[model samples]
Target: MAFSLGPRAASAGYRLAVFDRIGSTNAEALARARAGETGPIWLVAAEQTAGHGRRQRSWISPRGNLACSVLEVIDTSPAVAATLSFAAGLALEAALRTVSLEARMRSPGSENVTFHLKWPNDVLAGGGKLAGVLLEAETVAPDRLAVVVGTGANVAAAPEGMPYPAASLRDIGIDIGAEDLFGALTDAWAEFRIVWDKGRGFGEIRRLWLERAAGVGQHVSIRSDSSTISGLFDTIDKDGCLIVVTSDGRRVAVSAGDVYFGAAASVGAT
Candidate 1:
């Protein structure tokens, strides 16, 4: 199957750019935006040679994996733009469930496959990392902000020896191609992006996100560039800052951090 936009996405005037292989869909989307492309366009690749996550961390996306990015030029502040990552997570999770269920019906296997949203920007399936979302933004003009939300899912392959555990759909008995997942993703994104409403409907998005969120109310450690904070994972605030309730009863809002949970919290935590 080829990559195409869903009915809702197409009707909403979204465009698609499919690449058999590419250095990075996110990079290409950002480059197009910089070149005066004001769009709600999807850039998808069958493989990624130079894909990256937050902090420039390498993200593996060989052929048969889904490497897609969506570009939007909005008038929201950068901080508001960051909340769109939650919508991205919701979209990917929804798409995974939709495709996985179709796979299960064809060949019944493990019917216990579950998906959860990890704080900040990841989707967890059966407690292992299944997909990730990366948000990049640039101020193209005084009032125009260009944002690209990139999503990658391990459809047929998963990298080995990663710091955190990773899982692919095939590993968990879901045998589907990247194109099938991409089609679902565009549809899911359309639904959730409306809920996000260019950051205006973030309150509803936050509620929906917290509903499927993993590690909430659990002990977690957050590590940033300067220091590490260990505490209970309270909730994301109005502006999407992670609210961590410390051991000393202090509530600290973390804007960016690498999160660890349960036994892993003490590895590099304060």
Candidate 2:
């Protein structure tokens, strides 16, 4: 099927570029932004041959899924830029709710069937992987950065030969149209972009994120390099780092790591 930019971008007064297939939407958006693509451009594709996740993990991109990148210019430090992923997660949750999916910010003890945020940018559903967000920023000018927020949501089906468990919207009985879903996402993102532009930083965004956090104050394990630490989920720093209070009461700030909750009890230790 040929990819087409739907009415969402036009209604939002933004330009969009759609492709039938691409190596990666995020990479394409970054290139375009560097080449002077202005505000609010979307790069979407039906298939991504070389999609990637954080830490260079391969992302599966089937044809009938949501694979898109949103490019926006923001003036902020790298610290604040890191928080965009959390903000995007909130927007995505709101977008899912618009389609009657009962999506909310995931945190520990949510009582919503094991949904929670897997640290910086993953949304968990029913104790499995649901969706993930990736934020890539580059300095376009002094104090100015163009942020490309890439997201992949399993709308129809999840991957089969993956290491981790994955879920799709259809698995939860959500039968939303793809066009409607993308439109809702763009609307939510536009509204959140305004919040970021107003110099609110990540305070308000962080609070909303924590409300929907997947495993706040739960025993969790985070792995980085050759070391792993188990701790209670503490809080998120202003820069969007995961703060974990270890068993010894020392709060360790994890900027990057693979987080596993219930890993010790459910699955064997990592």
lDDT of 1 by residue, 1-270 (tens): 788888888998999998988999999999999899999999999788999998999996999989999999999899888899998999999999999888888887657588998889999885578899999999999978999999989999888998888989988878999999998999999999999998999999999999999889999999999799999999999988899999899999998989999988897575
Instruction: State the lDDT of candidate 2 residue by residue for 1-270, as single tens digits.
Output: 344444544676767787888999999988887898756787877777888999889886777778888988877777677778887888777776665433323223323334466777887775567778898989988888888999888877888877777887767656654555677777788767666653465688888889988778788888778888788888888777889898788999889887777655234235
Each model's Cα RMSD = 1.2, 4.7
Q: What is the TM-score of candidate 1?
A: 0.97
Error of 1 at 269 (Å): 2.5
lDDT score of residue 170 within candidate 2: 66
RMSD to native, candidate 1? 1.2
Overall local distance difference test of candidate 1: 0.91
Clashes of each: 0, 11
